[model samples]
Target: MSEAPSASPHTPLPAAVPPLTAPSVPPHASSALLASLAPLLHEWLPRQRWFAGKGRPVDRFTLVSATELMPLTGSPGLLHLLVRAHQPQTAPPSGSRGAPPPADCYQLLLGVRRSLPTSLASSLIGQVQDGPLSGHSVYEAMEDPRLATLLLERLRVPGPLGSLRFEKEPKADVQTGLAPRVLGLEQSNSSLVYGDTFILKIFRRLHPGANPDLELPLALAQEGCARVPEPVAWFEGANPDDPYEPYTLGLLQPFLREAQDGWQLALRHLADGRDFTDEAHALGRATAEVHTALAAALPTLSLGRPQTELLADQMTDRLDTAVQAVPALLPYAPGLRRAFDALRRLSSAGPAVSAQRVHGDLHLGQALRNGDGEWSVIDFEGEPAKSITERRRPQPVVRDVAGMLRSFDYAARTNQPWNPEWAQRCRAAYCEGYAAVSGTDPRTMPELLRAYETDKAVYEVLYEARHRPDWLAVPMAAVQRLATT
Candidate 1:
């Protein structure tokens, strides 16, 4: 372990270069063992999609808890951990406020083996030397079938791992000894399919309270909503911050083996030059059905003029931030502000609007089309950037409506000849279908819907700028349209 060498001013440095030694490790762990693994973790973490510290160096790891699941028995040993990762802090921008807060807590599962098979080489985290685990190759356990199966087995039978508790919902029957296959497309969490009958989603970043992903769906299931997959079993662990409330770690639900994601389905229709209006209409009805069920099951509120003004202010603030991050939005900022202004004025002129929990982040990708051609909404995690508190707050249902409209526009614009007319048809048809089932037409609230759409487009602009520079044009075009029309 040595200090990182200073780079020359003329040379471009990589965003993150791990220090020779780990900044910190589990307090109670064998110092030598953790010391040996620290360097490996520093290098392995940033490469993972679920790691929050992308483009930032991992300064240290503070262990919340660590438990050996199953020690080596001719195969790899299993270890489960909840660790807080601290990234290197940078000074705030000029004229900004206090320093950025420290990092997030993440779940880690490690497989310790003497040597990895050639097939498992890609999963290697690093090797250990001169420690309790010396001469072992430690890799992510989720990648190893044996370890993954063991995790499923733990959930199949109600059990406890140290402070962590695994429990099944009443009436849930999870089959044991099912084969596990890792899902590769997940970004923020790891999911495994068990025999194509059930899927277990392991939440990587641990949140203090109950995650809405599980809470909402479990409620929906109890309300007899068939549009969402119900949680069959879940796992949680003791939270030091709130001893009364445990941190949700993972959820198991029935797998929709015959379902196709709506994004792909929309793309298929676009590729065939076929109208997606019918499917869009059906999806709208499904969305309305879910909204009704949620309203019936959860607390609903009314956003009075003052609250509406505050909401508009928040939208304007978000626009200001997006404009700052994506300078291309500068030209449209004024027009977008006007939309929010209109919303504020309109709200003051009318009675308070009903507010309830809607899908915080809704898009085509969040919907799935079953083999029966019915649409099912999935992933109630909300916007990843929003805090758990903000996401769980009640909001106007039109927010979800606006999100879906924007997604339809995205589908149209992603193709050549950018068919706004097609998007218009689908959007109108969707609203019509929704109105038929819900008895309230989203299109009737023109000003509010416009404002939400503008907000969503601004959010998309910033997102595309940061993650997919090539896709930046898509949202930018919508921003221009919103600003002018």
Candidate 2:
């Protein structure tokens, strides 16, 4: 992966603050509390959808930082934490066992109370066994209105609080004390909508640099792009050691309260025996506009022969690894190889292809439609499986087109009577709309499109096999079609 992506002026970097994880926040007390919560977290962390260490036992935990946002003696108290979970590596590099396994740091906002509330029973993380919070009940803070509102207050007034820094846009008007409620749909993160005016997404997994979810949107907002919701405010950790790096822990944006989830909308259209050509075409246009803004705001590069060869190598490598994971992909190996290999053959004859910041991991689910039928892309957080460095790397816009194309196929096959023709129409219309906006037809670069599409199917094969064995056939069908076609 390339070196970590830096934030542009649009993303105003917070000044370095003294490290709050140590020499402050009472390290000994926090450590003792963490030790007592270890077993409870070990039981709770793996069960969370946002927990990355799924299927692996959490060997132990180390409290990276802890701050009492509100004293536990209050009616509702808040504890902000950056905790690292150490889990056994499935396949550590040779000789790595001598050292402890790599740990993933997670941002946890916990609500503590003396007595358990019946209403918040679902958010419970169990009672503490020892330390200052020994008998206090702790639960997810995002679900509690008092704690969630307090979070917004932290964002409204921008400044350093210990190592944490809260920031808002140049003239952002952050309304205070809106009743807060967490959205239940998010998988990798938790979000709370305050009075239908603002939504704050609390990142579960902590990263050391600016997350694209906030990075790209902030840039787009500065560029006056309405196709995506503008990020209003966010909070992060400011470490003197990593002075320039902003460890983003959350994002705050205007809540699109009336907007419908793009995936659910598509499914509804399909169930009604309708095609999504019009919606898909509009969505393609929206995606193109976003790409245009990103390219202008961020850096863009041309993929010449060397980069093209590297792209082919990565696709081929993934295919090879995936084939091992799911033998079903073995038969289509040669066909998939042909798709990637053609990239090398095309690289020699054509002018260099354009590569720019793109919506990594784009799919129907990441889009939202307002009541006016306008499309707005959300969640620029790229692929969760990839490192932030890799996710922010520039890539061909066709990667996004391929993702949406694959999503259309998924919608078709999932329906009882597989509607291949409907998916085809939507795919074609989408490409046409994209061309209308960007004046570049993705189909012009046939090999690149096929390679990305083929790579996506290979990924799906492994994902479905591992997570949803019965649904494995859906992606396998795409693999066969993409391979033989």
Candidate 3:
């Protein structure tokens, strides 16, 4: 698992191109084609891993936008769509049946063919019942090699497709015609690899802003940081009504072919029962390098007594919400607040804390190690649940340090024959490595680190309770340790 993270203060905002005004329907798209596909989408969407609303029945479908980039007369069709799926109302009163239920917008890349290729049978959504595509089989485009090739071709030659605009980085040399393969790992977004040269991440959830994933890494590359992959090409959508807010759809970057996942590497070291301090130290130094570069590239904020208090309030609020959802966290709520309370007092009496752009959701899984024994950081989208505004908010660098420290604990606890000392040694070594480069130790501010670590554990408790009930004990044990120790 590798993460992608964003932009500097001096980076110019993406210039707005005057909107492409034309007929509502793209030349190749038809209203009847969409009408036939709506029902099929309702049935197919809930089954896909990228679909957010699982375990809920779809009530209806609404078309937000649809562009037929390549039409099928005798060949297969390619459609790019943004559609809303309304969930069935479970708690609404009888009188409110007329009101529409809550809905979520999702992006779909569809490939329509008259006959199913045995290779693409598994990716089939369903056969269209009526209208223009009545006899065709529709499948996710990422699974069809031909459609995947089309996407890469578009990136290779940047141009517009209706409202969408594809642009290539000025200095990036994009080599196309490579075979595409979809990454099978479970993630918030879907990713496709084009041979060994490039990886394109297709965002499922759409937010109206410059995505930090694209913005941050491009900025770091500009800052001459080799610890991140170089961004090559990307696509964004602009609405004529609001040209200021562009929605980033996908990003293209150089693929690290020989890189090993940091999470798997840690597990291997633990399985072999070997010391990981050296690797941990290098990772810490890499983290520090990125942090230092980001501070210089982006605007830094100083958190005084008032802002610190607000931060404490947010921690307390998260704990309260977690208690309601997990119930098991209720007992540790008061003890956890002690950490935040200590932070409040420390910030009030002590000097102000420095805040800057950081990897908000840092963990071992978000890093990679190459054969040359160098570490690279990725995925700067922050917490997936947070809004774009929240993810972009500057915070103390200690938050990321705490996240990495907690991950070390996770590696020790989840692996058989738990050894606390292993994590302890690695944490100390990581902080030492960071301090050597940063000139300041993260452990100096014990209260802030403790508070952030506790907050992270609380979030894990809630996440495990909902997603992995059996693994819930990992965070529960951590909560007990943080509370008692």
State the number of backbone clashes in model 2: 0
TM-score of 3: 0.90
Q: In candidate 1, what residue range of length 10 has the lowest lDDT sum?
A: 1-10
lDDT of 2 by residue, 196-245 (tens): 88888988987677798998998888788998888888888754347787
lDDT of 2: 0.83
lDDT of each: 0.83, 0.83, 0.82
On lDDT, the stronger of 1 and 3 is 1
Regions more than 4 Å wrong, model 2: 1-24, 92-101, 239-241
TM-score rank, highest first?
2, 1, 3
lDDT per residue for candidate 3 within 47-139, as digits (tens), equals 777777778888777666676655554345677887678786456533454655336667788887887667777888999999878888888
Give the lDDT of residue 7 in candidate 3. 20
Identify the runs in model 3 with alpha carbons over 4 angstroms from their true place: 1-31, 88-103, 239-241
lDDT for 255 (candidate 3): 87
RMSD to true structure for each model, in Å? 8.8, 7.7, 7.8
Cα lDDT for residue 417, model 3?
90
Cα error of candidate 2 at position 405, Å: 0.4
lDDT of each residue in 1-485, candidate 1, tens digit only: 22232222223223232222212224555455566777888888888898876878888877776666665433467777787888877666567786576478889889988777765778889887656787788888887776777677667767666667888886888876577778888888899898899999999987778888998998899899999999999888788778877888999999999999998888888888899999989999999999999999999999998999998998998898888888889988999899999989978798788899888988899999997889989889887656678889999899999999999999998988788888998999889889988999998898989999999999899889999999998988889999998
